[model samples]
Target: MSSKFKKRLKQLHGSREKRRRQSTQDEQSRVFTADDVEEQDLGIATSAVDAWRDHGADSRPTARGEAHFLVRHHPQSHQHGTKRLAEGAAVTLEGFRKQLNDARLHSADPSRLVFLDLETNGLSKTSFPFCIGIGVWEGSQFGVYHYFTPTEADEPASLSACAEILRDCEGLCTFNGSSFDVRMLQRRFSHYGIEHPLDDLAHLDLLHLARKLLPDRNGHKLSQLEEDVLGFGRTDDVPGAKIPGRWKQYLKTGSPHLLLDVFDHNRLDILSMVVLLPALAEGLGSSSDSARFKNRASKSDLGNRPSSSGSDQQARPPKAKPKTKLASQLSRTYALRKKAQSGGRRQPETRPTEQARQEDVPRETVKLAGSFSRAKLRRGMPIGTRLRELRGEVERLEREGRGDEERDEIVHRLHEMVALSPRNPFALERLVDYYRGTGDAALADHFAKRLDETSPF
Candidate 1:
């Protein structure tokens, strides 16, 4: 009898493992067009919508068939945020702009940028996004719009809310979006016959970047980076892998409030991205721009917003320490040598056997040597908003024979364009044109070098 019982347990384990593998295979298959989807898929979308309607879950305005979903919309403003930077590398928006330009992206507007994270019931195609948390810049304040799917039927409405929010976003930032979050959501949208909306947005996958810059670090996971680079850590947070089980328990028995931890987990994920942006942007600067940006966010009720899980663990951000003058000078010398080689000017190779000849890492260079991270810096307004009007203004000014005045205004705009996007070769080239037209050889040459340095191609 004991042997029979053992045999049964082995069979059960084998069956579960087989199902897990099959689910993974299903997730790998994606729907791209109507030809790939069955008409029955649309019914699932409809039933999900019906579920929301039947449950009387709170509704938000959605364009996709007036579907109602449980929405947890928290609009934030007028609150001073109390979060403080732990005095790591100080990075300015301007500094990050340089890196952005290097990445060769067109724009990274704050208002049009949405930080997204999703929680789901499963990892494979069989699962749907149960919660979608979006951190967006609302005027000067940051607001998180969480779309909660309380039941299976709420899937359609929840997805629609996310689609609506994403429609206007110019870019999306995620820790590992390209691999999981994005691919899974796209699959969900395709399965439901709803158009995938994020295909066009500028996608910043922080995980890829972190891996590139922190190759020597112990691990490149967000949590690892939080501990190593940002000095922030989590407390009593629900493990992501166990989230689905918690939700399933809620659905089956509805006895526990453990789902709140999931929502809070989603919330902290959004905030972690928020807090890390400027710090990652700063690189090894003397002090972090986190404090500066936090101050800007503090004006609105966002100041007191909690970015971490609990107050149990405080971030042990690296202390801001200046490098000794000797170390700083040697670091510069080594940098110059590398830059010269990259410039194809290396003429010879020599090895120094003398211990003193070997340049020691300057303490100052240590900060700059830290691995890179990610974040955003706000600009005046979204790009498309007044561009046409500005063009019209320029045309009118030019037609009215205010060519010189128009040039000045153009220069002004160009200055802003350059400041906002230093890597913009077009802007740099235009500045070169303007300077040349003005017969300012020095200015023209200066801009030309700046343009050359900023150009990605």
Candidate 2:
């Protein structure tokens, strides 16, 4: 057989074996609670966990556990709280205030606000949320609330638990909840015949706020807000698109590990809102405060400058330079690289010229591609299209004798594409070509080996 054909066959075999092993392991290790057995004996498949395990083995553990745990744990707990946020502890008004206050002071919000983030199945009108996350500011502390679709026969009950928490809040905040999260929740409620309380709450969406406040900003993602304003970072959080797969994994295997990561990611999103609320408040509030202060200082300087023969103007503080063009370029590049990595793309080398135009790449395009590459790839568009575009642009530049200016752009784009679409043959081939063209035979061969290994007949 040809090497490519052999490799493809081997991959298929390995995939089959992996699936079989996972199935066997799931069946053997499945957690069988008395409740599940009771439901089964009654001829009712009420638990999503049991139903999932019956169908697909090798499911994620945390999601299964999350569903199972929610059902097993009573919705009402008498331990130090009034109502269950999700079958556990009630978040008191005092606690909420304290958390809100902390976020406000630390992040410097004049209004002392909170931000919310959520992940759902799709962006389509028909899409519904299987998971929800909320970020709230309480006093001086920041807290998060997350809910996953319950595994019990009563999915509505799980949603009710989430709705109850939201009802108690004086204000609701989210990044794009108005357009995405809220609407999805509303649809789910409608589907289940449940009532949604968010309609009455004081809702604040950061998406609108971000655009209004930072009109020149390239993107308005929560992660971008975190990096640009809050100066925070993250790593290895599962992409939102992988959430469904993780949920499926839990259903099959009854393992909670992958689900925990999802929960953590959701929690981080909630916390990011907490960070963002204050930062945004500060930016808006402090701007006027700063202007007033500057105007007063300027008037004083003007009066003194004339009387003192311009000595006061000279003595006054020098105007702070706007972040240098170079610095701005670097920041933009860093932000893009960071975003690419978060979305499961590779980080590229920071070439100086590429850094200059980093802002030119539409943030939405990058996000759309990163978040929906699986569907895109299924449609026969390789995940490396963006990288290809960049390489093509660079090649064109090189042909025009703008080699130095274009080289950095080429390298950066290649790096990001390779990082995102590590499995793409085109990206690997280009990397091989790039190294070969640049006289890095060793690196070229390294990529060549990877290409050969992953290539299908």
Candidate 3:
């Protein structure tokens, strides 16, 4: 027998013994019937409890059992990065309702509206949440609370604690909670056989609302909005993917150190929602109300803005920055990166004449890539060739299951095709379908009307 074969046999024998021991333990611990009122309190080691306490979390008794959580109260004068959590207190209820498009929020008390964010082990139904971060308005200050699950067994206690806080709130605000957090919590509550407290609350999902109202943002992610809209940025924050592993590590090693960053990440997410609500409401407010909010925001933001020689234009609305140069650079980079990422796709070859023609077109005169200007339209690029190329690109993108990722590019090309050939029913029909699918009734109706106008009965 070879040495390698002998070692492999020993490893397999050891694993078999381990499994046998686990099965025996399971059999011995099995219970025949469930008892609802009886609590199986598994006490964590004193060292582990002390470690978590050192990081600001303390063990508290909930209706279900003992849960570990942290609570911090921020004074009204305290600012989170560049924006004050107090600014959210200034949000008009009507404007906020308009921003989220939920009438129920119009009558809801602002102080009772809670910002919720969760840290979970994974996205699957089988996955468990380890932390729940909540923000609530208390008197004249804001409060941030985090409920922690020490183990999978502690989930019931943590959820109970979270529900107790949520019970007092009339409205819930979350970044992308509609698709993930809310569903996750519902599943968890169902799993634990507990009544859900969030069912009757006015849910304001900021993700979809942000995309609709702030279309010019680079991205609508909580972190992105925190930087772009709230003017707040995090340093040394933990990536969400690694959070599950941190919990597992703590479970194995009995060390709570890895979880410190996880708590910070959750805390920042809740705090950002505190400011993002008012910022988004400012855009969705009526004209006069919007102007008032903007003026207040601008005044508060004066410290971060560059000092102007003349203060006369202090109240003037910020002007849109030119995007000609940025658009050109982004277009080129996108093409190159797309080709690189799609390993099978080869770069298209261009003729010297075509290159020279592109160079001769002045940068200042260049329009957004897909949308053409009249000056560029005058140049003799064959309409048929461009249309064929665009159709081919769309087909390729759809074939590769990237239709959703590149839908905007596809729509832009379809519009260009229609522009070049006004009677092109195919492009016009596609435009109508695309808009309708995306829930844009106005654009869909306009395109449908155009499709009918171009059709020959």
Local distance difference test, each candidate: 0.60, 0.54, 0.73
TM-score quality measure for candidate 2: 0.44
TM-score for candidate 3, residues paired by index: 0.57
After TM-score superposition, the amount by which residue 166's alpha carbon in candidate 1 deviates from its true location, in angstroms, is 0.9
Each candidate's root-mean-square deviation in Å? Answer: 27.2, 17.8, 17.3
Q: After superposing candidate 3, which stretches have Cα over 4 Å from the reference? A: 1-47, 288-457
Candidate 3 lDDT over residue span 1-457, tens digit each: 9999999999999999999999999988986544522333323544566777887777778888888888888887778767787787777678656656778888887778989999888878798788888888889988888888766677999998888878888889898899999899899988888776777889888898777765543456777666556777788999888998888888898677788788889888888887787787777667877655444444433434543445544433433567775465445434533433355534322222444456786544544232344454478677787777767866765676744446655665666566566557767777788778867686678668767877787
Give each model a TM-score.
0.46, 0.44, 0.57
Candidate 2 regions exceeding 4 Å error are 1-38, 41-116, 123-127, 135-143, 150-152, 286-457
Evaluated against the true structure, the overall lDDT of model 3 is 0.73
Pitting candidate 1 against candidate 2, the one with the higher TM-score is 1
- Candidate with the greatest lDDT versus the true structure: 3
**What lDDT score goes with residue 163 in model 3?**
84
TM-score of candidate 1 against the unseen true structure: 0.46
